[model samples]
Target: MIEESEKGWLLDNGLVAYALRVGEDGVLEHLHFGGSLGSLAGFSAWPRQAYRSLQIDDRGKPFRHLGTLAQELPFFGRGDFRSPAIAAPGLDELVFESARKIEGGLDLGDLPSARFEGAETLQIRTVSRHMGLEVVLSLTLWPGHPVLARTVTVRNISDRPHLLDRASSLSIDLPQADRHIVHLTGSWAREMHLQRHRIETGRFSFGSCRGTSSAQHPPFIALTDTDTTELHGEVLGGALVYSGNHETVVEKDEFGAVRLQMGLPGGMRWPLAPGEAFIAPQALLLHTDRGLGGMSHGWHDFVRERLLPERREPYRPVYLNTWESAYFEVDEDKVEKLARAAKKLGCEMLVLDDGWFKGRRDDHTSLGDWQADPKRFSRGMGELARRVTAEGLKFGLWFEPEMVSRESDLYREHPDWIIGADRDRPGEGRNQLTLDLSRPEVEAHIESVVASMLREADISYVKWDMNRFVSDLDDAKRAHLYMLALYRIVRKLRKAFPGVVFENCASGGNRFDFGMLCLFDQTWTSDLCDPEGRLDIQSGASHFFPLSALASYIGPSPNHQNGRISSFEARRDVAFFCGSRGFSLSAEELEAHASSVKETAGLYTSTQSLVTKGRFDRLRTGAEIIWQLTSPSGDEVVILYARKRSEPNPPFASVRLRNLEKGSAYRMEGSGELWRAESLMVAGLPMPHTDHRANPPLMKALPTGDMATALLRLRRV
Candidate 1:
């Protein structure tokens, strides 16, 4: 799929074509990055206009400078004033040297990368014309998707060490295309709320400088046409394959050209020795003209097909966790009871969350000590796991492996093991300190402790939680190294226990990016399990992730996080939208709402596939929020409809469904009425006549309340 074209290089994956050629100045220039052209048309960069411009080439040739031009890897100096993708001291002028077809893909030593199948990899080598620095630009065109995964490795080939300053994963120029930036921004429990603005003359940037990929600004950005929507415009989606500090910048130069770059944060002074290389984390760029829905579908298919590590066991689980229910008070007897209750509730997994470790009466004491609480579980955790598994449920345990409590013995012995220990000690979060996994000893200790727990107990699943952020935001290299270390530990554990379903939760959904998505089986959508809050969080996350990766759960009536009383029915309705659904209600709460709880479990067991793996779309959002999920074969459709307030004699409302086959007839599950797919999508089906009756009153009464919810299921006849 990679061939030498008339112009330069054509890297095509039978679906999308990414063409690049050497400019007149010997630097690589981006030609076209859209649909295939049947055959190469010798497309090249447009003519440059240096009218009233200041930048110039080496020979003082005006209008021939790199500025106002589209470049492959924008250099630091010599012309382009915009931010460069790769930059370092004494390494400014890097010209295109040579390019060769790489075998499979370059192994990014410690950084996480996606597995490529039917991928055409081309390594374009660019070196400084003056300094002896080499930047190997590796680009992989993933099969069957308009996705390009790029990683830049800078090697110091010079005799002396060089200071590496800025290195981004991928950067591309958009020539004269109208682009509007769309991003997700929020805080801890309120994560992934959508935001957007049109790209103006100035630069617009969004990123996470907080050590962990902050929910406030996770590493994802979309450049769309001015009128882009869910199903209707060209969208260029960029998501970083990194869980640490990252940034995305969209710049509009005076020439009407746009440059978008995504990668690690700037201001890094890491040392690059004579022969040493710095491998950046991979970044993905997916292009689709079919709109945001198309972009999401492409990413979803890629993540499922290539990003997630292959597993042996089926993990479509309806689980119950002990967090909101028991918190730090769960004992062996309590866990066994929950396991039995989970089995009776038709749950497949029972996760004993965060209370089994020794000296862990509260969050202040036992995080590093991974031993079972002898006083709570006299027979040990292994026996308890057996007891849970005996009840036809997979046993899952919680572990904050990257954290240690000062009150624990592990920290008492090795207080210097925590991050920022030698320097200024980082302030504690949740009464715990984050272990410096960048150290070999700390990494080994964590790997040993986590693996031991998995082996000690029949842990079919693990709730890996990081409840804090990194201390130093200034050290980009340190954050990068910590991420690399974390990925190493996770990769090893994944290989050792291929069947265990690992779920990543950084105080719930903070680490919910593609990197963690690929590393773990599922991600907690949010710690806020309230009905409306879950809807918003899940909807925003659904913009980038498949429903299968977002773990949606239902808690008690008076939601623990928000203290907003919601019905069990309303909570279950929202949770059913995700692939991984769970319940975190205490025994008293469960007993109070037995019928609705039982109904949810039975329905979830029978129709999980329709909800979990279906194609998802956010139909509408304002007052009434609607979600649509259609089966792959176009036979079944599941729609979740919820409105917060009960309207007073409101106008007739209906939802137009999406993703159904044309000319097909779908039979409503409960109503037994058949409706054509086209008419349903276009004209829409009228919702329940809630709060008011039709002109002629109907016989049945719809569920009317403040937090009203309804589920509609249909199958092709």
Candidate 2:
């Protein structure tokens, strides 16, 4: 829905609107970008020249100043003194040249881009006076979504090369400066926790300078109204589709205007030779009047439809991974026993994690040597895979493809394959060195080896893990180069193994980003997957990623990560909300909880379509975390509740329902109680109690203890 007018252009998709017009000085001025107004009537009428104040430009015309107006891309050397979108000399202002509307999106050359199908793109071309630099700012709009993608391309038409120190994919000037920034910041197992603060008069910036987008700071930010909540108010969010070193900045200028920018970090030096063009990473802006849920649903739907359409549509498998069960000791005999136990538990796949490779007794050896350990797998890796598949289940194999051990055959033969192979003592994380994917030989080696493993076996799933970071990040260019190469290899592998489901795991949640989600089908949510400990991690991740892509698995009691002993039911209840379900249990514990495991797996098979792919809602209660889900067709409703710790004689625990038809009546599944949708939404659903509401008095109370969990299901009647 791109409507070009005499002034500029109007990009609307029924949900979000973005309009821009040429100013008096022939500069592209941003008119409106939040909510839709139905049409482009009287949009940039007076304000194209109305924002003049006491101060004036060098030419003495007050509104001629670029600093006062909202621009498509602000300049540094001209009148604007704020943070420029790109750091390059001789960049006066991007004077408006022409804007063309076309079907599908603009091509980003070699960079990874979102789907161009069914999307309308507006490319506004501008040029500077000094260096003959051409700037094309692209905005892509989807039909029924409140999300828009933005990117900037710079081409050097001049004879001289230009040095670009910083380049952001998108930059916008908002009229308001008073908004709170909501960002996710945490460490390894503790990833994607929501942290927010009100905007003030200074620059508040955060980003990941680590070679990879670190677990400390993910590449997402939201500017919300002060009264915004999980289900209400205004939230304008920005997410970068990049997996490398990145930066997001929210700055408030002295004139009370806030500028938001997302793209590459400021530390790298990028040279653009004559006739060369540089394309920044993509940035998605989502506007939602329904607050965070609306923002979240927009991203989730985009990921499903535009990002990984084919990969996301299938039934996410329920598997039993052997990470906790056998760790590095997962041999052929161990895998056979686990496959037997997994089949009885109704698991669909049995993933052999870490330790099947040649000479790989531990993480410190044989990582890049992608072959079966002859001693452990007496027959071969393929035979073990065949054995698992023969036992009425699919097989999954784990590989740290991007890492190499110095002691392995791959590293020994080609030491130069490592990131800093020339150094005498190159740094290492997790006792392994990162493969230099930037090298063509390295990519070919990894692709050939991993593909050979898949060809030899009936590998239905693959868990791709990267246990280390780029330790030699003295040059920021290394991060972006490695990412580009990694993307190329991932795309090749995806095309080669069309039937295999690939899950990305970076020590858990480090690669939990949209850039990877665009390639990998799913991600291991976290290594600390105990139900209670994962409450915050999963909740925060749900704000951005769809449940279908979050791998939430139930681990052993006295949790392997945190040592927290939780009930089997509690663990299963928490894992139910995530789309990709699985468990990692020892042989003894598998026998002990066989009935419960099979029953829970059966319930998952029955309700997964409704619970996993549904529109999820977060309702907050002080000490309890609750998630409500609505089926895509609007007939079924599911709620998962967890109490961190219980109290004696606690207050009545009830929570409101959302997103139901007003006149509908739903029958609660277990209790067989019928309730009207309006009453359930307005009056709320009471937590099950020991009262007479239960036919039998003095019955058990719901959520009765620490790490307690409860589930409620309602079907439309």
Candidate 3:
């Protein structure tokens, strides 16, 4: 709810509140943002007097105080020396002129934005008449969420076109200067690794110019004080709802005030013709004083409740993907064998990965042609779907609809359909060129092709993959338009096939962001299935996403990507914690461990609720890692993984469980040992000293080995 008080405006959404006041000069100034305060009465006592000293100037230009004060919309070339959220070489002088409340969210043409039933919105309009540009910044607050969704719309009100050198979706002014910035950074195989650093004096920024939301830098940034920890301290997080080229800038001004801005990369000069408008991507901001864990929970709740598709209950199918197993060698007979093996292992879905389309034998061809390969699938995909269904498994297929192979019939027939520069040959990555989704005809063609294939084959799932970065495009606006077009196509497909599940993959996590997650069911976490590497990847990913949004799979031993062999048990344990559990190995090859696979499947079924909808806690002690998942109703499970051999001096390691009811008595599932929650949390569970055990050993003596894994379940009694 938003209310106007005598001193300022108060925006409170049950979980958090943002308070700001219109100063004597009519400039909006940020006052406070954090936990919900229920009412605006507290704002009267806020330190407005302290800012009086900083506002003193003989010239009496109130705008000069913007450097010391918290501004709602600070612009470049203004007296404010801080980094401008919206910078344009054409419009060097811009200032906030007025503000107004809006009843509903502002539409962004074809772009996607967050919306909730009871959300309130406010628009602050800043104008530079000399430069012929007007910027309308919108902020939306939902009633029960701690997040504030923000976006900016730039309008060219003059006779000529305006070019924007920089524009941000949102900018936040933090009160304190001594804070730590936390961001996710890594390469393709190791995406979303958490990295934190103290805020410096100048600008600290990271972004993707790779055309896609590159794996090197995810669209997430956070700020917290030195006192912050996993379970304690205030944390403010911002995640861009864009999957294309994006950037985040963090700056600490001389006045000891920090400002954070996230939006389109600075390299692009977004053009806006007269009477035309350019709406930047949305950015979601979350504030939690309960700590990083609280902030994570806030993000998870928002995604599940507002972003994901509505379902009666969370669904996580036990899948067996044929990508790593069959690769491009899949045929009717081979797929049938895999389906039989999947059914025997209690898998519920069989996803046929790449190489099923026309004229495709390898990654070098047939990406845009959605038709089944006549030579490889002689019986057709419909027949294969039936066969898989006959084995009590649902069928899935893979497609790279947004890309086209230069060697395929689609590109040969319509060369103009691909995005490229005027004279440069379209740059190729993985032997494919990006489809010009910005073109209406190209988007329509892709929609028709993908929809026809799904309708023809009765595909229950679709693995939408984009294997290469976008390039060769001369116009900067095309990149942003391409993402908008992709969102429109996915939205249309979701409405057309409401029952089909979609998994977003872009060369493995390149497009992993809340924007895509809002449309797709889950994301392929990474191409690297090495259990050791996954431990770090999954852990880092869980910081922002819920378990259910992460697609985890066990690949063949001596993992296909990294060639690091791991025990079947270790791989299964790592994959089980993810919302969707699957394997990328042939079912037939797993016959030797059939019983163990069956047992793991059964265990997943029994604990699916705890793993998917539970609160997650990570305990890292040296090389040993313990992940605890606890349901709201008190059922809990923990997976203890040993990444390396145990040391001798300590004799044993201990892990204390979190989020338990201290007074309640709990029983361990396997050993039948019972203990009070308080005792267990205080005394802690111990690690094993040996590698083998007959019966379920106590925490004091768990199996010890390189990549050894153990499971512990608990129920409150």
Candidate 4:
């Protein structure tokens, strides 16, 4: 709810509060953004003192107003040394011209953004008449969520056109400084590694210029105090709902105040014609005084409830993917054998990874051709799909719809469909080029090809893959337009194939963002499936995304990627916490571990409710990691994993569980031991001293080895 007062505007969403006011010179000033503020009565009295201390000099002379003022929508050329949220060539300066409240949330044409349902919105319009541009800032607050969604729209109001250099979806000023900045950064095989640093006096930022949301930096940023931890201190987090080139900036001014800005990266100048408008990406802001974990829970709930598609609560299927199992050697007979083995081990689906298309023997060719290869499958794709389904398993296919191999027939026929400069040939990655989805003809061709495949076969799932990054686009706007067109295609495909589940992958988690998450059921966490590396990868991803949106599968023991041999128990334990569980092993390979595979499948079936729908908590100290999932009604389960061997005289450490009802007695699933939640939380459960002998039993003590993992289940009594 938004309430107006003599001081400024106060927006509340039951869990968090946002307040701002107009300064004497008509500038929209930021006041407070954090925990809930009960009433607006004392809010007005605090801004004056806060601004004065942050601005005034010791000699009683006031510094430049632009440098001191914490404007909500700051512009360039206004003496403000900080980065401008919106910048244009001629009209780099802007002032607050008008402000008012609005009814529905703003729209971004065909782009995917967070929808505000039954929420209050405030629209503040600022104009630079000399430059003939008008900027509209909309801030929306939902009823029960602590998140605020912000978007900016720029209109060329004058008779001439305007070139937009930079425009951000959201920007805010924090009154204090010396806060810690936390973000995710990594590369292809290893993605989303959490890194924290102290906010210094200069600018610190990270972004993607590779066209796709590159793994170099994810679209997430957070600020917290030095004392912040998983369960304590205040944290403010923001993420963009964009999968294209984006930037997040943190600037600390001379006065020790900090400004956080997130928007489209510079260098792409969008030409806005007279009366036409350009809408920036949406930025979702979350605030929590209960620390990083609280912020994570809020983001998880927001994504699952608001960002994902409708009816997203259904159980995610456990399947077997043929990527690592078969790779480019997959054929009708091989897939049939894998499907039968998958069914024997309780897999509900079988996904033919790649090399199923015509003339496709390797990744170097046959990406655009969506038909089954007659040489490999003489019986036809429809027959193979039916045979797989007859074995009581759903059939899925892999497609790199956005890419085409130069060796493929489609690329030879339609070379104009690729995004490239007229003068220069585009550089190739993975022996492929990107299809220009921004073009209507290209989009239509992809839609028809994919639609025909789904129609020809009884396919129930698709592993959508984009193997290479986009490059050599002549137009600067092509990157943004590409993302817009991709969203449109995915939206139409979902409508056409409502029953088919889509898993988004870009050589593993490169395109991981809220925008794609809204269109697909889950994402491939990473291409590197070594159980050891995945522990960190999944942990960093879970900070912003829910476990249900992450896909974890047990791959070969001597992992195909890194050749790191891991125990089946370690791999299965880690995969169980992921939302969509699967295996990447062949039928012949599965026989050696058939009993273990069956036991793990049974465990996944029994714990599906807890892992998918329950709240998740993490407890980590050094090489030991513990993840807990608790239902809303208090049933809980925990997974403990130790990466390294213990010391010669290891200290006895207890693992404490979180999110349990205190004073309530809970029964352990295997041992039938009853313990009060209060005692369990306070004293923690002791690590077992010896290995257990049961088939699927909990560990008696912390296992010591290169790879070790244990599972514990509990129910309130």
Per model, state how many residue pairs clash. 0, 0, 2, 2
Give a tens-digit lDDT track for model 3, residues 509-605.
8889988987898899888888778888888888889888888787888777777868887888788878878878865566877887788878777
Error of 3 at 437 (Å): 1.2
Model 1: ten consecutive residues of lowest lDDT? 693-702
TM-score of 4: 0.95
In the range 277-392, model 1's lDDT, one tens digit per residue, is: 99988999888888888888888888877777676543567888898889999897788888887788778899889888897888899889999989998898899999999999
lDDT of all the models against the reference?
0.82, 0.83, 0.80, 0.82
Best by TM-score: 1
Candidate 2 minimal-lDDT segment of 10 residues: 690-699
Query: Is candidate 3 or 4 superior in TM-score?
Result: 4
| Candidate 4 lDDT, 1-717, residue by residue in tens | 888887778888679988887776666788888888877886543544334445433224355356666778787675565788888888655657777776758767887877667878988888887888899888899887889988999999999988998888879988865699999999888998999989988899898878878788989988999899999999999999989888999998776889999989975689999999999988989999888898889999988888877764557777888988888998877888898899989888888988888999887898888889999998888999999999998888889999999898998898888878354778999999999888988888888889898999999988899988888874668888888888988889999999998889999989899888888888988998887888888888989999878888899979888889888888887888788888888777788889988888877777777776789887774577777778867866564545554455555556777877877988887788888998888888655542343223443554656767677677888
Q: How many backbone clashes does candidate 4 have?
A: 2
Q: Which rank order by TM-score, best down to worst?
A: 1, 2, 4, 3
Give the total clashing residue pairs for model 3: 2
lDDT of 2 by residue, 1-717 (tens): 888877567888889998888877777788778898667876543344455565447356655777767877877876677777867776766788887888898877546777888999999888886778888899999998888999999888899998777779878889854689899988878888889889898788888776777788889988999889887889998989888888988888776778999999875777789998888888999999998888889888988777753754568768898988878987888899999999988988899998888888877888888889888897998899889999999999999999988888888898888877777899988899988887888878888988999999899999999877678756666667788888888888889989899898998988777788878888888888778778888888888888888887888989888888899988998888888898888888889999998998888878778765788888874578888889998799888878888676566667889989999999888768899999989999876542335433322346456888778888999
> C-alpha displacement of 623 in model 3, angstroms?
2.0
Model 4 Cα shift for residue 452 (angstroms): 1.5
Model 2 regions more than 4 Å off: 44-60, 311-313, 689-700
Error of 2 at 608 (Å): 2.3
Which candidate model has the greater TM-score, 2 or 4? 2
